[model samples]
Structure formats: structure tokens, C-alpha cells
Target: MRALSYFFVIFAIFLAPLGVAVARHLADDTQATDWRTARRDSTGIAPLPAQTPEAVIHVYAARAFRWRGAFGVHTWIAAKPQGADAYTRFEVVGWGVSQGRNAVRVGEGVPDGYWYGNAPTLIRALRGGDEVDALIERLRAAATAYPHQHEYRVWPGPNSNTFIAYLGRAVPELHLDLPPTAIGKDYLPDTGVFARAPSGGGFQVSLAGLLGVTLAAEEGLEINLLGLSLGLDLSPPALKLPGVGRIGMSEE
Candidate 1:
């Protein structure tokens, strides 16, 4: 019992800085009530021009809505197959589910846009000849067949992160490197706790996204507690902290 108490104390000490950082971000005087009132333009992370290029796929993630941004991020996948004129994006949203609308939205839109007010960070980019096009096709199939099409949960399971994470698993060739701040990305669609990590490069055991452990090549090893994550990225020698996310020079 005493050991457990010590462990928690140490954890809190490490998490303290992240909490402060998030608090500072939210301390910004500017605020908005409606989601639409927030920014939605691209941050110029996408290299594809307005003309739209074929054989391209971009996976992006950004801080989630409102205070939740302090804890985790929302993720989405966008792809433009060969000869396609526009990009198709796939992601899950909770607000629509509450308003009698489908949780999953798939269609053409800005391949990269602000999530609420948070500028997006591109995680994976694949573009080339016919070979890249083949992977994009698989991504489309996996996205359309998402198991939780009508379901949505803000925390733990089947949220935006879950949607894109599932795609990474379905098509591992993309080699997704889901950030630790993507809170719901670890939820396995299966009845069992053990399953493939979102990167599809390792194994993970999660309990409805509340608690879990992951040991994967892309993500390294991580522990999820109370919807926040902390881990070590052995591949790049960095510390994955809760509120602050990854710290240290990342080779990625």
C-alpha cells in the first residue's frame, strides 16, 4: 500500500508540468462558444496544391475541442487516389451523434483543417506512383467498413482518434505513429482486452481506454491511466508525458 502511494506521488510530480502548460494555453483571453465560430482553415501542412494530386494520403491529428485539448487530440485520415481530383476525409465526431446525426463523416473537404481552433499536425504523408495508390484504396475500404460507424464516445473508446487508429491497424503499411495525446486511439474493437496496437506494429491491452499498456515499434511502450498517457519512445529517446505529450528530441 505504501509503495502504491509513492508511485502516485511520483507520477503526479511528472504530470505537474503538463498540467501547467495546458492551463496556460487555456488561460488565453480569447474564447468562443460555437464550434463554427472557431477557425477552420488549413495551417499549410499539406503539400498537395489546390489542384489535388493523385496517389496521396495524409493523416493528421490536432488538439481536441475546448478543455479536452488539454488532455488529448482528435485524428483524421484523408486520401486522394490516383486521378482523383479531390481529397476524401474520414473521421468520427461526437456532436453530430448527440444531434441525431451520424458520428462518422466521410466526404470531400479540406484535407487538412483546424480541429475546432487547434492547428492540425500532419502525422503521415504518402504519395508516389501506382504503389501509393494501392495503399490509399485499402485505407478507403477500411474507413468505410469502420465497426463503430454509428457510435461515438468522447472518452475511452470509438472517438476520432479511434477511427483513424483503426485505419492504421487495417493498413499497417502506412506506418502510423499515433501520438500519446491521442487519448482514445488505443481502444480495440474486439471483446477482448489484448489486441494490435493502433500502429499495427506491436501489441496492446486496454480496458475500454481507461487503463492499458502498449509495446509497439512505432509507439514504443506506453501506459494509459485516466484517459491520459505517459510513455517512453525508445526509438527516439524521449519522454511521453501526459499534458505535455512528447518531450525531448524526437527522431521522428
Candidate 2:
């Protein structure tokens, strides 16, 4: 009996560390996976080829500008399987000034972590099919789940670009300071040609404006039947300015 008791005590002592090790491991995992601190995306958008979806449901975007130089860009896309009608909206908004030097850059360049630190849902919906309704519901859920305020980088000079992304919300009125006459509605012949300007002057295509509003109200960044083509050149674009030799950088 004495020997058995001694053996039992030894075994219990040996097992205690193993149990403690397991508990510590579980705690570490939980902390690493929590979104409040370090979030991760299981459904983020992939690279260009990864975005080539088979079909889509509904998409929208918009941009608003105030004469003083404040402007806003919004984009949203609702997508799902073929039989669904509801749509998901991803939206973003930016309101500030850039003394004409550069454009404000919103959201980080990482494709997966942009949506309030969550994965972008557009790619997932496209994979599902042409069901708009389902897509919208998913987007609504994501938007509801988004954290309220976040900071993004912007431009310093006049010739810069700003980009923003949305998670979910209804499209809002594009309040522009320019009179209807100043804001000419130059609809492009081919929907493909949504918006185009000489890189510096003001720009607003019906498609870009509409999509900006949609995204401002919804959850996705890329939307519409036509889709999205976003390019951020770290290297300056090919522009020949009298004073500024040739702006140059890289592309994201």
C-alpha cells in the first residue's frame, strides 16, 4: 500500500505539468486568433486573376466633391449564387483637402485586411454565383459587424489620388458644391469608359460616381456590372509638368 501510494503521487506530479502545458497552449491560441486585437480574413479578395468571377448580381459606386476641395469616394457590390436577388454592399468614405499636391489614400493596400481589418466579401460572393439577395444579406451582416472608426493614409499635394472602401450601408446623396452645369454629365459611350481625365483636373464618371455612393453605403470596394479597375502607382504617372521633372515611384 505504501509503494502504491508513492507511485500514485509520482504519477499525479508528472501529469500536472502536462495539463498546465495544454491549458497554456489553448490560451495562447485564443489570444492569437481574437479579432479585437489581431484580426484575420478567411474570405478576402484575391489578386486580379482570382477576381475573375463567373457571374455577379448588382454593383454600385459614387464620388462627391466640394469646391473647397473636399471629396468623397464610395463603392459597393452585391453578389451571390444564380438564384439569389438580395445584395451585399461594401462602402467607404473620405472627406478632407489635399492642397492639390497629392490625393488622399484610404485603407491599406493589403487586399485581405482592408474591410475594418476583416476580409473583403466581394470575392466570396462572386464565387457563390449570381444571387444578389444572399450577397446583400451577407454584406449587411459584415457591415453591422464592422468597427466604427479607423484611420487611413492620404495625399499631400494637388496631383495625388485618394481611395476608400465601404462595408455596408444605403447609398447617400452625392453632395457636390459644383453647380449642375459645372458638373457635366459626360456619360461614356461604352460603359467600359466610366471616368477619364488628364490625371490632374477634376473627374467624375456616372459609373464612378454611382459606384462610390454604393460602396460608401455598402461593404465592398469593387462593384457594378462593369466591375472595378483600381491602380495605385507609387511611382508617379507619366506626366510632363514644366517644373516637376517627371514624377516617379512604384505600383501597388
Candidate 3:
């Protein structure tokens, strides 16, 4: 009886936020459209490359398509080199991996475009001159070096979040603080239970992205269980819940 009670407590602690996430997802009217015909238009969030004429980098996250939005988000990166006419977008997608297609996609799209029908939230941005341009070059190299280019797993894996996490580690200058709703961000390929946090602010230990603890200057403290994260942020004070994401202070 004691063990059963303990299990129930643990389940509630981890799953309560997921329940809230489901409720919120159901209440969102934006998901009503079918994916094939869903809106992928730009939100006019990123600056126009031609007008800016300087190096720029952006990281964006949006709720995943369909029911997955109730659990986590999909993340991607975009950059424009100094004086470049267009922006380059980088992301890992699982669209055709089963048939031997590469999961990493490097293509041109609206830098801040919607994912399917979901409007994206900007996670980070860096705009500058030569320094930012240098970072963009390194970011391109990191995307090419991602080890899981041909592999993908929707849960606890080397999926889209994992790809962004890799880029964060590879280019620590980004200082990315991925939201807890990024289900696969804890996955560390070849690192084996220990690695630098995705933000490069501290360190973390994760077991196949299933279970872990993160202690970071930027991320605060996070606990990962079964691909769901729960934690607290001290700087601006926030509660990080599994699917509901951070509640309290806004990210800097």
C-alpha cells in the first residue's frame, strides 16, 4: 500500500502538468486546420535580410503539429550572413527517414514562418556585424556535423529538439535556453549520461533522454523523467512544468 501510494504521488507530480497542457491544447483554436492545408506563412517576426544588411541569427519554437502540441514543441534555427540576399534555415525533420532520407534539412524558408499551422515563438536572436557573421558560419558547420543526420526518433531521441540542442552545444555563443517543453533537448549523443547543458551555462546528466538532472546558470535546475521536465528558475522566478512550459517570469 505504501509503495502504491508513492507511485501515485510520483505520477501526479510528473503528469499533472501534462494534463494541463492537454487542456490548453484542446482549447487552442489555431489547430483546427488539417496539416496538409495548414498555414505555413511567415509571422513577420524576423527582420528583412535585405534591409538589415548585417548578420542575424534566430531560434524559434512552436508547438508540434496535431496532438503532439499537447506534449512538446519543435525547434529550428535560421541565419543570414552579412549582406546575404536570403536567410538559411536549419532543422531536423523525420518526414522520410524510414525510407533512407536524411533527417537534417537545410533549405530556404521564411525565417520565422509558422510550423504547419502553429505560430512560432522566438526563443533567441543575435544581430550584429562581423561577430555575429562569424557565429553564423560556425552554426552552419555545426549543422553539417550533427551526428544524427540520418536518424530520428519522436520520443526521447535524436529528433528536432536534439538537433537544436546539438547546435547550442556546438555554438555556445547562442546561449540557448531551450524550454522544458522541448522534449528531446536532453538527448546527448555519445556523451553517455553526462554533458554540458544545451545553453553551455552548466552541466547535466541524462539517461537516454529518459531521466536526468540539469544544473545550469541559464536553465536553473531541471529534472527529466520519461522525456518530461519539471523544475524551478531562481533568477526571475518561474516554475518549469512538463508540457505547460515555464510559468512566471519571461525568458531573457
Candidate 4:
């Protein structure tokens, strides 16, 4: 009886938000477009490399393609070296992975390109001289050393979110605070069950990213179940829902 009650409580706390997320997704027309026809144009959110002489690093997250957007988001990192004429974008893409291509893609493209049709939200931005340049170098090295370069899993394991999460741990100074909708963000590779949160300001324990709890100054308190996260952010007095994301304050 006690076990049954506990299960119900957990279900209500986590699953309820997921249900709301589903409803919200269904009602949003922005996700109804087909992938092939979806807009991939830049949203003009990134600094133009030719016009900006300072080194810059940006983290972006957009709703996942198609139905997956209802559950989670896709994240990536973009950087520009001081005086560079182009931005190099780094992200794990599962599209050609089945064809034996590497999952980790590093190339030049629009720094703020849309994810399919969804406009990306800027998660973090840093601009400076030598310090930002050094951070970008570290980020590049971390991307090269990512363990699951040949693997891709859309849920509960090594995926795009997982890749960004790895970078966060590798370069804590980024202080990446991945939102709750980053489904695979909690997936720690061989790093064991307990590790620093993606934000580097907190710690989290996970069971293969399916179940976990995170506590941090930046991330607040998050409960991860079956790859969905629910939590409360006391600093901004926000509620972090599974699909709807943080609801109380503007991230900016």
C-alpha cells in the first residue's frame, strides 16, 4: 500500500506536466509544418562575424523537429574567434548517423539557424577578447573528445542534448543552464551516477537519464523521470514544467 501510494504521488508530480505539454504542443500551429519544407533560415539573433571583432560564444536551443518538440528540445554551440569572418557551429545531428556518418558535426553555417522550422532561443552568450577566445578553444577540444561521436539516440541516452551536456561538464565556466526540456541533458556517459549539473552550479544523480534529481543555483531543483523534467526555481519563483518549460520568469 505504501509503495502504491508513493508511485501515485510520483506519477502525479511528473506525468501531469507531461500531459499538459502534450496539450500545449497540439494546440501550437508552429509545429505543424513538414520537415522538408520547414524554414531553416537564420533568425538574426547571432552576431555577424564580419561585423563583430570580438570573440563570441553562444548556446542555443530550439524545439525538436516534428512531434518530438512536444517532449524536448535540441541544443547546440556556436563560436566565433576574434576577428574571424565566420562562425563555426558545433552540434550532434542524428540525421545521417544511420548511414555511418559521425553524429558530431562541426562546420560553418548560420550561427542562429532555425532547427527545421523552430526558431532557436539563445541560452547563453559571452563576448570578450582573450578570455572568450580561450573558452572557445576549450569548447572545441571538448567537442572533439565527445565519447559517443558514432552514436545517436533520440531518447534517454546519447543524443544532441547529451552532447551539449557533456560540453557543459567539460567547460563549467560556460555555466550552461540547460532548460528542463533538454531531454537527454541528464545522460552522463561513463561519468557515473552523480555528476555536476549542466550549469556547473549544481549536482545531479541519474539512472541513465531516465530518472534523476538535480539541485543547483542556476538550474534550481529538477526532477527527471522517463526523460521529462519537472521542478521549481526559487530564485526567480518559476515553475519548470516538462514540456512548457520555465513559466515564471524571463530567462533573459
lDDT string for model 1 (79-103, tens) is 8877777788888888768778888
lDDT of each: 0.81, 0.29, 0.91, 0.90
Off by over 4 Å in 3: 1-7
TM-score of each: 0.91, 0.23, 0.96, 0.96
Preferred candidate (lDDT higher): 3 or 4: 3
Cand. 2 TM to true fold: 0.23
Query: How many angstroms is residue 235 displaced in model 1 relative to the true structure, after the best TM-score fit?
Result: 1.8
Name the regions of candidate 4 deviating beyond 4 angstroms.
none
lDDT of 1: 0.81
For candidate 3, the per-residue lDDT at 175 reads 89
Q: How accurate is candidate 4 locally (lDDT)?
A: 0.90
lDDT per residue, candidate 3, 25-71, as tens digits? Answer: 99988694687898888999999977999888999999999999999
lDDT tens readout by residue for model 4, 1-252? 999999899888877878888888899886747878888889999988878999999999999988899888999999999999999998999989999999999988889988998999999999999999999999889999998999998988799999999999899988898988998999888746999999877899999998889999989999888888889888768999888788897767
**Candidate 1 has what TM-score?**
0.91
Clash total of candidate 2: 68
